[model samples]
Target: MAGGVAAGLVAGALWGLVFVAPRMVTGFSSVDLTAGRFLSYGAVSVLMLLWAARGPRRVPTGSQALAAIGMSVLGFTGYYLLLVLAIRDAGTEVPTLIIGTIPIWVMLLGKPEHLLWRSLVPGLLLTAAGLGLMMASPHAGTTAAGSPNYWRGIVLVLLALACWTAFAILNAAWMKKHRDVNATEWANWLGVATGLGALVLWLVAGSPARELAAQPQLPLFATLAVATGFGSAWLATILWNVASRRLSASLCGQLIVSETLFALVYSFAWDGQWPTPAQWAACVLFTLGILASIRAHR
Candidate 1:
């Protein structure tokens, strides 16, 4: 359980990088960024699989391969595409706040049969309080609520939230049911599937290769893609899988608050400014929520 908690926290830290990643390469289309990142992940996964083939790694069966593809679409390619589009349309604040409710939804739906509802109240309340603080913070930015694009962005974010929430529950259930399927192997399979899906998305929607090549920040874009692909997508998936297999889905869901916390830290660092008192307090509340959830689980 300790190992699982640590893994989940680390995964959150890595996953947080994605919140700022699209901003870093603002010139690129969402499809390009998504494709580049997952392509790198797929490349790495393929290389690792080849290396492991010399040893005794288990290859996924046909049914498992199909499952990987479906999950990759839900949790990786489709979800991220929608997220990038949401941020592009509506700015970051509203979308982020809406997405922040994911832990609450997951906890409500994924609660263990043995765990009492009262045990979850403290964690849920603390998390909600943290989100409230974040929403009230000036740094969260304001959106034009009346704009068509804003509503569209809100819709996109909600869909993104739904995709990931479903993924969280189903992925946990899948990992728990298939105890023989190790975390690393599952991550690799998903990586390959995501890469394929991202490739198709890119081919269909990304800018032409010549136009992308002409961009001044191409190298920066590539670096961010590779860094996030390896750390955030591939490695984080392994850590998350480990956490899912070891912890209840509700506990794992609570731990996702760490991602929002780390994302704020990264966003502030990138802007070369400190967080406001409200933001700092929110971070504290988020930490308390995770601890409360951990206690409840134990």
Candidate 2:
């Protein structure tokens, strides 16, 4: 249990880096950022697979590889694109708030057969109240520093939330069905798939060429990409798997709140602004709601 708690905290901290990385390269659009970040992720994943395969690890079949790639599209490529766009158009607060609801969403969608309506209702109400507080808070749209489209950002983040919920549930199902594949290996494969997805996005969607033509900060961009790719995406994936292995489903669900906590901390630090009074209250409410939901699920 202590190991699970430690892994959850570390994973949350590492995952928080994603929220701040988009800020560092605001000059690039979300598409460009996704491309660069996932390319790095793909490269590292390849290296990982090569090293692991040397130790008698089984390589994935073509069909299994394709399944992983498709999941990576939903979980990594598309999700990052939407997340960065949300952070760009709104602030971290609203987007993180929406994302913070993912655990509840996963439980609602993934385990509907086992839900207890009595506890579930109260849990949902608390979650709704918590989200309402965040929406009504004065700090809701102020944290982005320069973003201008809060409504658009909110919608994008909700989409990201759905994408992630689907990814989490489906990924778990896949792993359960294929016990031969270890978590680290599966993560690396997803990274490879994300790279492929990013390449397609780069070819068809982004303005990376123009963004670069306009005196992009190459060094800073590279550093941010590596941090997000390796630290947030790769390291967080591994640590999360560790926690998931050790913790019960309900406790693991509650622990996801740490991601929102760390993300909020990093967002405030980046902007050199303290959370407003309402923001602080909202945070408390969100924590309570998450706890309630997890308890209900249990």
Best prediction by TM-score? 1
Badly placed stretches (over 4 Å) of model 1 are 143-148
lDDT of 2 by residue, 1-298 (tens): 6776677668878877787788866567788888988988888888998898789877779989889888887888999899998988887777887887876675565554555557666655665676677778777666663655777888899999888877767775676677677778878988888888888998898775766667458778878888888888877777776666655444455566668778888988888989778778777876776567556644
- Model 1 is weakest, by summed lDDT over 10 consecutive residues, at 139-148
lDDT of 1 at 76: 93
lDDT, residue 153, model 1: 87
lDDT of 1: 0.90
Residue 233 error, candidate 1, Å: 0.2
Clashing pairs in 2: none
Location of the lowest summed lDDT over 10 successive residues in candidate 2 = 245-254
lDDT of 1 by residue, 153-232 (tens): 88999999999999999999999999999899999999999998888888999989999999999999999999999999
